[model samples]
Target chain A: MTITITAFSKSPDQGMGLARDTRVRWALEEAGLPYEVRLVSFRAMKQRAHLGMQPFGQIPTYQEGDLVLFETGAIILHIAEHHAGLLPNDAHARARAITWMFAAVNTVEPPILELVTARIFEGDKPWSKERLPLVHDRIRNRLRQLSTRLGDADWLDGSFSAGDLMMVHVLLRLRLSGLLDEFPNLAAYVARGEARPAYQRAFADQWAINKPAAKAR
Target chain B: MTITITAFSKSPDQGMGLARDTRVRWALEEAGLPYEVRLVSFRAMKQRAHLGMQPFGQIPTYQEGDLVLFETGAIILHIAEHHAGLLPNDAHARARAITWMFAAVNTVEPPILELVTARIFEGDKPWSKERLPLVHDRIRNRLRQLSTRLGDADWLDGSFSAGDLMMVHVLLRLRLSGLLDEFPNLAAYVARGEARPAYQRAFADQWAINKPAAKAR
Candidate 1:
């Protein structure tokens, strides 16, 4: 079965590969699976067709034959579960890896997401300047804990798994904020993730679509 | 293997069962698994021992034999994968169910968490009153999409899988805000989740620990 995943017709990030689709694409690349991309405009994402596939009407819905899955974590996990590279063979190790995956999204990413909300959506608000520091502080708190746990480790757990993939992507959002630089280990960690052959391929694939040259074409 | 989990020594919700441990307990109950709970105080949670088990220093870490797991979604998923009731048998349905679990935490809960942050942490800010409507509007946007998808369905997908278990728990947070009532189907969906015997048992168990009378004892 050919796997088909969705991406933004034109990513708001403009080829930075920060979009959620990059996560799914990276997972597929790691799994060595061939997949196709279906681009959806911001408008179509809210329409009945796309909403049927993704309840939240978000980009990056995964489809293979009769199976349709949304949410980047789920898509990545599904790919990881079916393939060998993305998860460990040991049951306990695999469970721990999955735990890291959840921790990345639920515990760690929420604060980082709040920083995005503070900067983008509420940037012009009267309190944005004052509230921005608080959001950054909260993000730093999480990063501090994460950095402590990660201290000099190559990946989150033993080897690179979907957990690391998800964590690196979540941390990528903080790059522009300069918070990621505060923790040298985490910054190096993100660099390592980006250094992966799979990640590079995935990044280039999305970059083709959102690149200014492609837009001009 | 004896399954042991951790909970707040005294939940901030005061027995309302909004804590993450409640979700883990609910999953265990639905799976018909008997487990033990170890309560940890806020100060103790920040100490080395608890922080070792949970890197983020949050409650609801699961331990069985040599395996230790934190993050309620991961714990519930671990239980559901090992046990019977919380997931479906079909592969595709199971993937979709897990998708909802991620959706609950990643997509749906983030805004709800923002609401909590606005109300509890930022309530004293000069911009609290003015900024709240923006936060509430963001939540309403998600609820609108969710309510539209739910329509007349009893669950997000079918047969009351882990997806419903998670989505219901995420929506439960909105009850105090009165936003849930705006979407009648969503309100009824939460009611159905509450009516479950497993959920009821989980609720009562936590209530026993955090109830005022029990706290006095």
Candidate 2:
């Protein structure tokens, strides 16, 4: 069955590959799956059609035959479960990897998201400047723990799995904030994830779509 | 294998069951699995021993034999995968159910968490009163989308699965905020979740541990 995933028609990231479709695309590449993309405009995403597929009406909904899945973590896990490379064969190892996937999103990403809201949505607010450090410190606390756990390790656990994929992408959002640089090991880890052939392919695919030149085409 | 999980020695919620451990306990109850709980103090949670089991230094870590896992989503998923009640047999339905789990934590809970931070952590800040409405609106936006999707349905998807388990727990956090009351359907949905036998057992279990009388005893 051909897999179809939705992405922002013109991503807010403007080809930076920070949009979540990059995460799903990267998972598909890692799993060696061929998938098609259906772009949805910001307006259409809130409409009935897109809302039916994604309850949150967010970009990056997955469809394959009769199966439809949203949530990047779920999409990646579904792809990983069906494919060989993205998850470990050992049941315990696989469970541990999945734990990391949850940790990445639930524990780590929430603080990073607050930083985004601070900078982007509430930038002009009276508290924005004073509150910025508090948000950054919250992120740093998480990164400090993560960096300590990741010391000298190549990936989160043994080999690169969906956990690493999710963690690396979550850490990517911290790049512009310079918080990632404070943790050298995490920065290196993100670089290693970026160095992956699958990630490279995924990045290029979204870049092609969102690039200024491609818009003219 | 006997399953052992951890929770806060004295929860901040006092007996209300808003903690993530309640979610895991609810899943175990739904699965008809008996488990043991080990309570850890706030200081202990940040110590090396606890951090070894949970890198993020949070509670609700599951240990079954050599397979140890943290993150409530992953733990509940592990239990649901092993048991019958928490998930559907259909592969597609199962994937969609897991999608709701991720949606609960990633999409919906983040804003609610921000509300918690705003009220508890930053309540003394000068901008708390002014910025709260913005945070509340963000949550309302997500709930509005969720309420629209739910309509008259009892659950997010068909049958009560881990998705509903998670979404209900996530929404439970909103009760004190009064934001949940705005969405009558969602409030009823959460009440429906609380009314379940499994959920009732889970709540009573935590209440036994954290209740003021029990603490005095």
Candidate 3:
């Protein structure tokens, strides 16, 4: 059975690959798995059937044969587990790689999300200006700690795995904030991830989808 | 080798079971794993050695023999993978369960964390009050989607697994915001999770460490 996934019809990011589907797409491309994309409008997303695939009614749901999965982290993980390249063969290294995947989403992404909230959704608020600095500081604080640990290392653990894939996606959100540039090492680290062929393929694929619409606008 | 975990010396939650360590403790209790808790002061967490164990320098890093892992999602996953009960025996089902776990952390928790950032960190911001409603709406929107899908379903999947444990914990953060009350089903759902004997045991065990100080306050 063909694997099918859903993504935003017109991503708010203008196909910069910030969408969660980009991660899933990147994983699929890395695994050399040919899949189909099902673009969904924001309206259709809240529908009953769509909500069944995603309880939170978010995009990038994976469906293969009888199995259906939601969440980019989960979808990428499933691909990584079934495919060879996304994880390590060594037992300990595999466990550590999985740990970094969780860190990327759980620990690092939270503050970045706050920055987004401050910028887009809360931009009109009176305290948006004052609160923006605090959100930035929180992100910087996390980045400083992470930079210190990642010092002089290419990846969070030995060899890149799904962990780095997720981490790069998380850090890419900070690109607009300029917080990533503060740590030269971290900035270079993210650059390395973006430069990956898999990431490039994913970026181009999504960008192709939105390019026409952006031009029309 | 025994596993060493880190936790707050005195939880600021004051035994309310809001601490991240409680999640690790709950998972450990459920796994029937014997572990040691190393109380960490906020100052010590920023140190080099401790940061080595946890890149983000947060509590609840798992150290068993030579293996070290951080991120509650990763630690819980490591525990669930090593043990039996936290995952399903069926390969596909297990993968889906893992996906829900990621969704809990990556999707659901982001908005709740936004509420926290707004009220606690950005409370002093001039636009804090105006931004609060937007944050609440974002959370409510996610909750509504979740509630609609969860309609009468006891769990996100077949049986209670680490996914539910993570999801329940993520939803628990909304209790203080009163947003949970907007969705009666989700509020009840969280209660169901809290009612679990394993969850109770985990709560009590961690609460014991902070009970005296809670009394003092």
TM values, all candidates: 0.98, 0.98, 0.95
* Best by the lDDT measure: 2
Which number leads on DockQ? 2
Q: lDDT tens string, model 2, A53-72?
A: 99788999999998889999
Q: How close is candidate 2 to the true structure, as a TM-score?
A: 0.98
Which ten contiguous residues of candidate 2 chain A have the minimum total lDDT? A208-217
Per-residue lDDT value at B82 in model 2: 88
Kindly report which residue pairs in candidate 2 clash with one another: none
Name the regions of candidate 1 deviating beyond 4 angstroms: A214-217, B214-217
Rank candidates by lDDT, best first. 2, 1, 3
CAPRI tier for the interface of model 1: high
The residue-by-residue lDDT of candidate 3 on A1-217, one tens digit each, is: 7999999998988877898899999899888899999999999988878977887777989999999999888888889888888999998898889888888888889999888877887688666676677888999998998888788999878787899899889999888878999999999999998988988999999998866463554
lDDT of 1 by residue, B189-213 (tens): 9999999999999999999999876
Per-model lDDT: 0.93, 0.94, 0.86
Interface RMSD of each: 0.6, 0.6, 1.2
Model 2 local distance difference test score = 0.94
